[model samples]
Target: MGYNGPLNNAKYLKACFTKPYKFFIHSVVHTVSHRKGGCDVMKDYQICMVTALVLNKKYNFSIIVFHYMKENITSKSRILVYLRFV
Candidate 1:
């Protein structure tokens, strides 16, 4: 069954990732939720992931790109720091 409701709703999230998508979805959700904040983090992550999934489905975008970009920004900042020290 496909879900078309608000992702922040635990019921929808639970229903949406029942079979094949369960492990991957749960891992991503847990990783994102814990990495971002403490309270209400899961809800925030649900909204973000829903937007990302929708955009991915509609525009053929890769969510991995967001991960890459985040890493890239961190690496760039580290490089800048190294340059400043040199």
Candidate 2:
């Protein structure tokens, strides 16, 4: 949810420098979390929450973060855009 330091700075940096792996961790984690959803209920919740946190950090876009990033964007506009994209 918040800006924590890299999970594995070395690996992350390597991923950033390498091809196809710039977003490798995020992609793999997302797939794994989605697959886990069908197996265990509590684990699924944990995976979903963690995945949301990872995505929030990687994209730097979440409701809370978005307000901090663009103070000028109105909540109504934000909701409208989100709905439209969905």
Candidate 3:
């Protein structure tokens, strides 16, 4: 994704400054979309790696978002994953 406007007018960027999940989903969506190349099936993306360290210590929700990703996009034998909770 390239810049849409001038740096001085980066209101959209500033607006998303506090949203990390959006960025994570954005990057993963791009990578998986690129790898899938127009496929909608979860089993189509066989060579993509998507991992997340979900930490919500305040609510005791420190989980590795692996099963969620797998449930969303199932992979083949080439899917590499290394997820952990800290």
Candidate 4:
């Protein structure tokens, strides 16, 4: 038999990876919701936004580089907004 990798739960692994993306989306929604109060919450909100971008750049190897142009694989975080509507 050919070398097959360890037998593991694929669904669970997918859930683990997608969780961060979902959380990122959720935080943005919460920020918009709370933005209407006209309070100083946006400063802290901006910090959270920066932190998410840093995490995506730091941890996601998939988005590190493009296949042909050699440009960084920019994350489509805005796609999360579409997801929220769906």
Candidate 5:
């Protein structure tokens, strides 16, 4: 987890973990929504896993490392953090 702040209503669950010297990370993203229908205030959760050259390197580059889908492992988080994966 890098940052945490939400003194009142909801303190989101943000986390980040990595293996030393590894060029990858695992994180969970949560979306908070408020709607006319209270029941529709539910959220959508997604998992994000990425690998890239973000360290001390000559050049910087990032590419889709993996995608996780409930039905197919061939897919990963897209709707929320699609830009990061690209």
Candidate 6:
């Protein structure tokens, strides 16, 4: 399965922060997408996690977002439902 769609804006944002690290964004998405039992929301969440790590590394934003995600998204079903609106 090839990803022909335009790169997500998050990829650009990651590039802006650290050019060297941008390459992982698409690879991570691609790798996760190819893995069995993963869904669209999980892929999206992985993107979000990558972005968050980039932002946290550059801007040092409070890690509350990570904690919040971990606490709220306790199950695969919950992640699927929550990320649908995110």
The lDDT leader among the candidates is 1
User: What TM-score quantifies how close candidate 1 is to the native fold?
Assistant: 0.33
Q: After superposition, how far is residue 27 of candidate 4 from its true place, in Å?
A: 0.4
> Which pairs, if any, clash in model 6?
none
lDDT score, candidate 1: 0.45
- TM-scores of all candidate predictions against the true structure: 0.33, 0.19, 0.22, 0.20, 0.16, 0.27
Model 3, 1-86: lDDT tens digits are 23333444412332232365456545544443423343222221211232222332232122314454554356665554433221
lDDT against the true structure, each candidate: 0.45, 0.36, 0.35, 0.33, 0.26, 0.44
Q: Which rank order by lDDT, best down to worst?
A: 1, 6, 2, 3, 4, 5
Global CA lDDT computed for model 3: 0.35
Candidate 5 has its poorest 10 consecutive residues by lDDT at 27-36
Scored by TM-score, the top model is 1
| Candidate 4 TM-score, C-alpha based | 0.20
Q: Which 10-residue window in model 2 sums to the lowest lDDT? A: 77-86
Off by over 4 Å in 5: 1-18, 21-24, 27-55, 62-81
lDDT tens per residue, model 6, 1-86: 22334466332333333445546664554443433343332334565656676566543323534444555567555543222212
Worst 10 residues of 1 by lDDT: 77-86
Misplaced by over 4 Å in model 6 are: 1-19, 22-42, 57-86
Q: Candidate 4, residue 63: CA error in Å?
A: 28
Better of 3 and 6 by lDDT: 6
Compute the lDDT of residue 71 as modeled in candidate 1. 65
For model 2, the superposed segments whose C-alpha errors exceed 4 Å read 1-42, 57-86
- TM-score of candidate 2 to 2 decimals: 0.19
Q: Write candidate 4's Cα lDDT for 1-86 as tens digits.
A: 12123324221111222344445444544443322343222333333443567565443323311221232123443222211221
Off by over 4 Å in 1: 4-12, 35-44, 50-54, 57-86
- Candidate 2: deviation at residue 55, Å? 0.1
Error of 2 at 24 (Å): 16
